[model samples]
Target chain A: MAVDTRKCVGCSDCVVACQTENSVPIGFCRDWVVEVTDGTYPTLELELRSERCNHCDNSPCVRCCPTGASHYDKGGIVVVTHNKCIGCGACIASCPYDARYAHPDGYVDKCTFCLHRVEKGLLPSCVATCPTKCMYFGDLNDPKSPVSIMLKNRKYKTLIPEAGTKPQLYFLI
Target chain B: MREELIVSGRMNPFIDPHLNIWHWQIPLYLFLGGLAAGILFFAALFYLRGKENEYRAAVKIAPMIVPIILIIGLFALFLDLKHKAYFWHLYTVIRLQSPMSWGAWTLMIITPLSFIWAALHIKEVFPKWDWKYQWLKDIETFFQKYKKVIAWLMAIYSVILGVYTGILFSAFNARPLWNTSILGPLFLVSGLSTGTATAILFSKNHEERKTFARIDLLLIAIELFLIVHMFMGFLASTQVQIDAANLFLGGPYTAPFWMLVVAMGLIFPAVLEALELIKFRIPVYIPAILVLFGGIMLRFILAYAGQMSRWLY
Candidate 1:
């Protein structure tokens, strides 16, 4: 995964792209562009970063879920099945990043990496919709996958490396 | 404050958030659960001490009370929380700094222990019936062999469970009423008094009584002394805490505090104890039930009314 923050605007196109594709529930955005700006007027520097479910190898949410509603499939995408969920919002409170929420109907929902489209050999909606082509997604193990090659050559970091979640999303600063 | 959230003191009509209501309800249920767990553990402790007089009643009720208390606590917590959907989150947390976190952890451990203890009591009662199901029979025998070990652990756990409720509130530094160090000891004493009182009230006739009124008399006496110490500690603590002190001492909570806590909780129970001292035959159950009611009301009033404090002068 590659995130080129430079030349990238916080337009939330990835969020719209996700909602258009999945028809995600209202108020539940799979992708978010967080803007951090400090200082006043000319002294201010604005920075933008796109965030979503990182699909960590050691995902805390899946392990903490009692009903096994929130889980990671074989392909390493974190998934939530509405039917199996008992609406306990345990996942909502468990996520330290505040990434998940209980849908108005009581089911917990979060980013899924657009696994349905990925299965059909298409990039995630975020990667596909990024006008500046700042975001990249590929297999980490291939070494030949653009993500692995770029990660090896570029100075990039994952969100919350301290948590040791082993997130797949990488950021290029 | 947002225009929509403009809270009015006099006309507000208790429209507080559901989560706040749930917080109070959770502690109430926990106090009751802790009391039940404490009484059962105390009974088991007496049984292990070769009190043949107490062992029979312990064997009969010790295991049964916990599961009932736990079941009721769980129901109240879920109902009070309103949205049943996020209820699972209580089990998913592991934050040690949060008292609610400790409660979830302790309740998890106590729940299974109570269930196993209950199963063992059943096994003890129907040893011959267990022979029909070999696996169950084997499990029963295993638990039977380990009853003493389980009883001792239950006693230790009950102490933690009883006082932890007080510690849970005291840990929250923002609430002056709960922030006092004495609250933990106060809660523990109250837990024991309520537990002993409950046991006495529910105990059978003289032949199989689980509680001796003499013991409850002593327990209530000690509990009242602890209550006095707790108030004194709060009163002498700090001027910043003065408003809350006023609330309990001679303010909004004074009437319930006096009628319920002073009269019903302490005086009536003490009168029962005095009757025992004088060799007068007074039914212990009446005072026991009243004190138990008074103790529960104490928690209810304190938990809710305590939230009204503010730093704004």
Candidate 2:
């Protein structure tokens, strides 16, 4: 999905939206903004990128897990089976994108792109609530979807694209 | 919007935050397994020397250590588990591509074999059958024939346990400091050095002690050489790798890495082992304590060094 951070005014409505919609437990978020500022006071350029589970084509978290508790679910979502997890934290450590966390309960937790919501004909909580519309969700393979269309038209970058997770998310330049 | 939040949920911030599995825990299995191996190998040398007291002591204690180290490792692992009670599910790792899966499988195999092997060594510990029961003698003979075979297998398994931790560290390609190919050999050597020191320090006989002393001296010298080689490997690499190496040599984590590994681990053990060879005088338990301390330090340094990411790239 294409994320035009320029449109984002830094309001975290999207963050909270993701929360209530998916019932994400307190003290964690499935998607958020990363802000970077450069140059002196007068010349400062501030930029932000909203990020989530890249759901990469080739994921490291999948490889490092010993218990097979971490894997790709339907629609290419990187889902962690909390019940099956031994909480070894192998996946959390291996993820270069810093996408996963070993929750206090010891199971790996992260954004599943609101798979439950998607199954219910609703946009991801984050995408639906974005005040600035900075987050987008859609099948990367469908060339005609709004996300696929925007991805083709805009110059954007994915986090650590060189790592070859072939992330589905994008930061619109 | 006036954001009243003291801290954003978006950020994962904890002081010395446990980075999931990368928390401060130094995969204690390496140290414990090495300790077991150290004890068992020393026991073997005692057997070779025919020092019955040392052999009996070494054999008895060494076998006991196999389970202790395994249990210690299990405890460390469970402590790290998010679902501590569901820890038994670790045995269901059917995947071959995952090291955690392989480690779980190895642990299952190693624990049982260790119990059987240790059980075989303790003849008196086994339940005494009536003298008239003729079949029990065959069972005794069977354990004797396979004890050496089991010992060899145990040693190999021990090596796998030791080396596998290093391999686990290196698998984190994003963490370049841990990505060195030298890590596997480095860990294996560290295990041998630590284990041998443990064996020598704990032996019950003078000659039994001396044999492991020579081994201790040899291993310490080798480890010293290996330390140099590891540094050289880092120095020969990219700017990113060099900065990562500095985290160990004379950089931020240098104090723990050097003081613990070089001073407490390598130098002290070497000096103590040398006294046995030259002055022919050595303290009984002091050497063992120092050596085990050193081994622990070595692993502590290795682990600490690995976690310090240069991010120079």
| Whole-model lDDT per candidate | 0.66, 0.69
Give the number of the best model, judged by DockQ. Answer: 2
Query: Quick one: best lDDT, which candidate?
Result: 2
Residue-wise C-alpha lDDT for candidate 2, range B1-313, written one tens digit per residue: 1121212245553212324244445457667766665555545455545564655556555565677777887677767677676677777766777777787777777777667666565554345624355675576677678766766666667667667766777776555577677777767777777666555554566776677677777877877887788789889986657887888767888888778778877887688778767866668567667767777777766666665563311
| Model 1's DockQ score | 0.04
Residues A1-173, candidate 2, lDDT per residue (tens digit)?
67886886667677788778766677777666666666676777766666677887777788878877888888788888888888776776666566776566667688888888888988888888887777667887788887888888888877666555577778888
- Chain A TM-scores, one per candidate? 0.90, 0.92
Q: Which is the leading candidate under TM-score?
A: 2
Docking quality of model 1: it rates as incorrect
In model 1, residue pairs whose N, Cα or C atoms come closer than 3 Å (at least 3 residues apart or on different chains), thus clashing, are: A87-B85, A88-B85, A88-B86, A89-B86, A90-B89
Candidate 1 lDDT by residue in tens digits, B1-313: 1111211111111212211222456557856865765576666677678773554555555456768888788677666543476566556546554555566677788777788777766645556544566897688778878878877887877777777767765654444565577677777767777776666655665534324556656766777787677678777876536766777788888898878877888788778767765777777677778777777876777675555543211
**Residue A148, model 2: Cα distance from true site in angstroms:** 2.7
